[model samples]
Target: MGERYLKSVRLLAECLQGFERFVAEPVRRHGLTHPQFDIIATLGNTPGMTYKELGERTLITKGTLTGVIDRLEQKGLVERARNCDDKRSFLVRLTAEGDTLFRNVFPAVVAHGKQLFADYGDGDFEQLDHALRRLRTRLDTPGLVTPGGHVPADEG
Candidate 1:
């Protein structure tokens, strides 16, 4: 059982690495890193999330989030405004340019994700999606125990 578990872990790691590489190619062509894209996508949906919220939503560290936000702000893809409730914190929102870029690129992103799992039939996709959702819910549940006895925020 231990050997089997180890093999499964190794396989999952390889799969994740491969998926990252595959997605990285297109994101690079769009002139954005994975973290940059994540921030933009989040801002697109949420509109006004503070840096701390972005870090939580993207599962990025505070240090890394600052760099990502700085780069995007430099590119005019996002803006930092003072949060009304907390003057000390800045809320992030996508610029008009950022919205345009997202609109143009998101369709391709969706297609690329679909193509990645295209080998799986509809039934397989449904089953995999269901299993992944269950796993995600369990992992996200507060105080829920993992094999390591701690449920991490970035379970990925």
Candidate 2:
């Protein structure tokens, strides 16, 4: 049973790594790193979001996020403005140039990535999504005991 779960974990890691490598080339062609593209895609079609919100929405950690935002700001792709509702926080949004880039590059990159799933049917997608969500929910649940009948150290 443990071996089965371990195999799944290995496969999941491999899948994530492959997906990253597959999408990375298109992102690089746009002159952006994976994290930068993630931020741009997250902020695209949206008004703006605070740093906290961005951190929550993105895979980037708060520490790395500041640096990524700084680089984007330097490239004139994004700007930070004082949040009207919260004077202590700043709202980050794409510049006009950034929006244009997002409009052009986003769909192209998405299309390129979608090619990976070209053969996947709707049912395949549904099954995959359901399985992943179920795994995530189980992982997030508290007080889950291990095979040894004790809560994992992190869970405890």
Taking all chains together, the TM-score of candidate 2 against the true structure is 0.87
How many clashing residue pairs are found in candidate 2? 0
RMSD of 2: 2.8
lDDT by residue for model 2 (25-71), tens: 88899899988998999889999899999999886788999999999
TM-score for each prediction? 0.79, 0.87
Clashing pairs in model 1, backbone N/Cα/C closer than 3 A = none
RMSD of 1: 4.3
Candidate number with greatest lDDT: 2
Each candidate: RMSD: 4.3, 2.8
Count the clashes in each prediction.
Answer: 0, 0
| Candidate 1 residue-wise lDDT at 118 | 69
